[model samples]
Target: MQHLETMPRGLPKAVKKCLEKSRDSALLAVETYNKPAIKFKSGGYIVLMVISWTALFHAIFFRQKKKPFYKKNNRFEKKDGDYCYWELSTCVSKYFVADTNNPIRKNLEFFIPLRNMVEHKSIPEIDSDIFAECQAMLLNYDKIMLKEFGNKYCLRESLSFALQLYPSSKSLNNAIIANPSTKPIVDFIKAYRSGITTDIMNSGEYSFKAFLIQVANHQTKNTLPIQFVAYDKLDDTQKTNVNRVAALVKNKFVQVPVTNKDLLKPSVVVKKVQTALGNPKINKNGKEKDKFNMDTHTRCWKKYQVRPENGNENPELTKPEYCVYDQPNDTYLYTEDWSDYLIEEMAKEDEYNSLYE
Candidate 1:
């Protein structure tokens, strides 16, 4: 990573300042996380990393000659006479506008709400549970920095593996059990994880999961003590070998049958959407009526093709994110995302009217 003092003189003034602040913030985040004395590792790390990411996005936008501030009435919004810059969420939206399901974006999104949840409270129990996403966030930050500003701005060299004692298998569970106040945070984490697709959950770009196996020291004294192998980059034979080794230490997981508690009926979805939209009323057949009803929901499902019509031969064909087929009941169930999508799309006058067309 390039030191701030060594930054190129030719770089734009605003971009240089943003980049310098970003790099410093990132370094501070890593320092805080790696410090053995710090008990609030996750909270401190997240707060600093959020600032780092926001500033990094600002630097990128500035490099492209674009302002990264909110505008209203052709004027930049100001706070205390200084221009208000975009937040991390806004930056992510603008940067990845074309791809909503990007794993890197998902990882960042996970932390945005999490940061808020932990702001006023200490929840160190979550550190181990969210390690994968936290690692991926830092890696993604450095990767983007390198891509945008070349090798000179990379953070790889400045960081080292955080030393740690091995944790007991039930440490995370025990921590949460001991702290009843952590239930809300735990629930939030689980709900967020449940909402995302399995593919995104497993994506290394979304969350970096790995096994650290202890092996005998190499013959060469100077050989590196640790190395990271990219599981996705490995050949099939190599993967099989790794899996065989992993099996010896893998924890046995008992499968539990899933319940349909999260799956909502069509009526429930309609009610949720209507309530979310302030229960707007419209004229239907010359009488005032709820604008978003069963018919509207039916039109939405048909228009989005989130699920097949009733009595279709392929009853299981449904979008997992928005809708799912309940085989035993032979009915389509909706997800919270479905209602949220409706609330957003229907909130628009044009989009709501298009349901009729």
Candidate 2:
């Protein structure tokens, strides 16, 4: 384990302290999650890792001689007589200010809200469903540590592949069915996933998904029992071989819910946008009238390019976060994010005017 004494010499005192605390918190998070006896692993790990990430960002800011504390009226905000520090979400926003769509930032954003939702509840059934995101969060932490500091502070040397019993698809399903209370969390996960672009959804930095296949015994006993190969780093031939192997062992345990239970039609989307925006009015031909309607909805989708036009040969090409093509209905369905996005954007006079212009 990297210790305070081993940290780079002549570093700022605040940076050193934050780095040490961050490292310890991350190590504890991994230890907590890997404990075989612990059933509620996700809850503990998320709380600790959020702290770890916040501290790591604090360390980076401190190294650059920047204060990460919240400010009120140009003065540091105080909580219980102590300065209030920026939370993980704020830290991410500050650090990645220039790149809002960064997959790493998205990964952290996913956990920030999730940590709150799971704080007062126990939803162990979600562990397998969100394992990819959890794994990416930890890996992204180590990556940032290496980039900001050096290999000396990296967590790779201190961590190992966690031992695990192969999961049973039937048992996991039964557990989820038994815990009906987890519906909200499960729905949130699905909704959040549906709102992201396919590239971000597939990005390893956002969610590290992999297949663990058993291979034949090595010719030499000195070989490691497990090895991690980067899919992107592989050559074309190697990638093809990996793909073949993955296809052979891949099993679909849980299917994505594709029913139209939550999908909103255009009229419903317009109503949602109107209500969400407080039913604001606009002047049409010198008289007051409803601001948003089907025409506005059509304009919004066209302006945002959420989906192809009605007669377009390829209708499925859409920004999944807001819109999706429903083949059976020969129409585009909208997600909750679509209305929410319209509410936010069209709230501005300039954006609302642009849709018409």
Candidate 3:
């Protein structure tokens, strides 16, 4: 085994360590993803990729601001212990200006959930379906690395596309379609693709698009293979063809927009939570009170500490509103996101009861 040590000679120790760790995680993610024989390599890739991004942001925070990236919590206090810092997602969401729309955020949305799923169970051989995302992950990593550090430390030249044994796209598609084992993987890809915006789905920057076309012979020995022409760079005829293909694909996987208007009433939110918990109702003060009822939701509003009840008094309490209260209507309008959160939490409670109660 090769001897290894972190050398924080010239740079700040935290910054150096974070950068090194990020690069190591990214390289390992790519390597694990490429090895087809590796079981659940996708999970390894996603976990490491997320760690890489988290560490990257940590390094950036230290390098730019010259302070520790983590935040302190009074709960974890000890005489000699250090304060806890934010995780990658929290750091990015809290500090990063690219929260609205960026390749890094877009890529993370997919990989983070994937990391969660794969942590619970093994994912079958379906990495090829998300080839674009995997490719973009590395690309975005290098882009950020170059921007944060410099061209001297860029890893672009060190990496290349993983060579596949079977280049037949038709055969691969057919196999995925026919195989029972791959059904969940296909469904996941389609569902994920359909949820995003048209531009995001098509953006090569967000997810690198590569069309595998068969070629008979090379034009020249010196001329490099694997030509990638952007949609804007294409000629009129080529652009028309690309548009047609995009339309066809879009039609098949219709995009479902997730808007705030899909928000649920407090009653709906209560019903969902109650149903998820499988709790019918309980007698309370000569009236039926659901175990996961409006009161429960009210408690959740206080517990989760996201939606502010007194937005009118202290608007700062609802800085980022997940639920809006309509004073005129005298009702709380909880977002679909809030409803989902409640349901997930309720389900977890139910599972805990079933397991331990």
For all candidates in order, the CA lDDT equals 0.84, 0.84, 0.65
Name the candidate, 2 or 3, with the larger lDDT value: 2
What lDDT would candidate 2 get against the real structure?
A: 0.84
Tell me, by TM-score, which candidate is best: 2
lDDT of 2 at 181: 83
**Backbone collision count in every prediction?**
0, 0, 1
Error of 1 at 76 (Å): 0.7
Tens-place lDDT digits, model 3, residues 1-357: 001153425557777778878878888888887887887766788888889888888888887764543434625433446646667666667555655566567676667656666675565455555666877887788888788877745566667767877532332344366565654444445445544556877787668865554677787798667666667789999999887876775566444223234446677788877776677676779997776776677777776776566545753344134665433223455666787777777667564334323
lDDT of 2 by residue, 164-250 (tens): 888534333344597988766665565566555668888999999888877799999999999878889999999999888776666
Which 10 consecutive residues of model 1 have the lowest summed lDDT?
252-261
In order of appearance, the predictions have TM-scores of 0.71, 0.73, 0.58
- Candidate 1 stretches greater than 4 Å from native: 1-3, 171-175, 252-357
Per-residue lDDT, model 3, residue 211, is 50
Runs in model 2 deviating more than 4 A are: 168-176, 251-357
- Residue pairs whose backbone atoms clash in candidate 2: none
Clashing pairs in 3: 70-85
